[model samples]
Target: MSEQGQNRTMVEVHRVPPTPKASRSRMWTDLYSEHVDRAATSLGDAEHCPAITIAQLGSVAMIRLDLAAGTIQRTAEQIGYVAEPTYAFLLQVSGTASFSHYGQDSVLAPGDFTLCNNAVPYVYASDGPADLLMIRAGAGTIREHLPSPEQFCGRHLRADEGLSESAAQLCLGVCEQLASGLPEAVHNRVARNLLDAIATAFAISFDGLITASAVLTGRHARVRLFIEENLRDPDLSPGLIATRLKLSSRYLRMIFASGDETASAYVLRRRLEECARQMADPASAHLTITDIAFGWGFNSAPHFARSFRERFGQAPRVYRREKLGVGMPLRAVGAEAG
Candidate 1:
């Protein structure tokens, strides 16, 4: 971090390139624990440690993290050390990852970006070594003009598309400028511009679908959150949700109608995505395809297989094999043959 004034300091924290493996891992872990949280673990190989370089720009922070193939998660129980909630907008510079939060999951590639809530539990697992640019800011900065920010959490927004591209570019530029040193007034201006760019990116894409008035969008956000929180319930339905939320079924449907998918479709899609995510995880490998399906609210094996194929464009077992980079199991082959 470089400092201009007393409060305005640009501090950069990174691992010393030549450090031994164990010490490097410990250093990276300690750094993240201090700045980010203690929940961060080295996802690299047994001897390898992921490296992160963070630059703090007053209220907004930028980080360039290089993570090896593995997983990192922040649980709800870890919220105490997190202080106030902030919005972490991650821009995938290279590599692929499955980002999960708010009952939504997305596979992000280079030039793709997403929002993560610091107040909630979230997981980011890399398929391989990955580089990411994360801009952290107050939630209000991005949420002020963006309608239903929850809807976009963990949802991939293309950096090459519309205002999102501009925002990503702006972030990179701001970081570059700050790194080279700038006046305090210029730093503040750049920070404000970065926030505005983020707001523009979100509003241009999402706000166009709703109103500036927060009532309808706020209700929609709550509804989406409820759906995400209850996605595992097999009996989850718009009617059930409406009853629980003390709203009429018709109004619930109307609220979701403002967006793309219907309530039922959205629920099913999320369930399918979640099941797919679990199927991709090695930890869940002990669970059979049937168990995984049933665990995520799919009652009928055939129905689950059908919907899984429809949503993912392949059989669940096939998708699992692709994710694990292995051939089909003998049992799967026998089932297919039978």
Candidate 2:
């Protein structure tokens, strides 16, 4: 075999051939776990502890993550200590994965696709060892169409339900082609085409089909759920939300207006309340005032302080110190003043 053929041999493809049920299940479990471990190590850090194998075919990085038939525990600290920015397209070839992102959790069964961002801390646990195919793309590329590119900074999004099947098939086809070891030029072109298709799939998946009102409504609900779940994202705004939901700015406003509040107000209230609750928690004594504020989506310390004072009766620092027993050191109080 040539060097190219040798590279191709590194990738193992399962055709889902006819076999006894027990035999197939065992084979899948082993393959999926090995693949996940390999891919996780290849990405930024083993600390991310992703058990998967990754293959680079041109611009696309194809990952086969083996999720053994059991619960896999993941935390922001485990995946990688630092938050990195990248886009991921995940396709489930077998079994299921329960994903938790921005406090919302969903189960993705076989043939389902999800868009995941590495900018946030989240966890995904599988039902058993399952096959997961992932494609990574640059941040700039995925950001262009996002209403709040930052909102997706650390989030996972499922393709609205209608588009999941088609997206899964397309991703599977791309993975198969990459595994075949085409010429470099052909591979690059194919990878780019696949990326475009994947992005389009995401765009349509989140926004729904333009032609079908029912489809659009369903898509709209998913978008709303995302917004509701991530209300503390400081960068959350109408434009960003609209872009992700694939709605015109005016229409997005109308959608929000139809409810009791405007989009911006809803996001702001949610963030403020979340921060207030965190500050009121006695267990949060170890965290600084700014840390609590930032964790709940307040970007500017002064702004958060001001907002807290306005919403409550005192500054966040004072509130935490007095109400939550988070005693502030003199140095820390001076830092907040400055």
lDDT winner:
1
lDDT of 2 by residue, 1-338 (tens): 11234345245443323455445444444544443321111111111222445566665677766545433322233344433456667777887776655443568777766666554434455645577778775566555433333323223345455555666677787666556655565766766767766656555654533333554344444565567555556777888888776788887766655457787766666566656655654435556667767887778888777777877878766766675454545433324711
RMSD of each: 4.9, 12.2
Query: What are the runs in model 1 whose C-alpha is more than 4 Å off?
Result: 1-48, 70-84, 95-111, 119-128, 145-148, 163-165, 180-187, 210-214, 299-303, 313-315, 325-338
TM-score of each: 0.73, 0.48
Worst ten-residue run, lDDT, model 2? Answer: 38-47
Best by TM-score: 1
The TM-score between candidate 2 and the true structure equals 0.48
lDDT of each: 0.71, 0.56
lDDT of 1 by residue, 1-338 (tens): 33443444455646535477666656766766677655555445544456666776667788778777777766545555445568888888889987888766788888778888776657788868888888887776656545356656776787676788778777778766666665566665677777778767766666544554567667776787677656668999888999999999888888877668898898888788778776776656666777877777778888888888888888887788877667645443223311
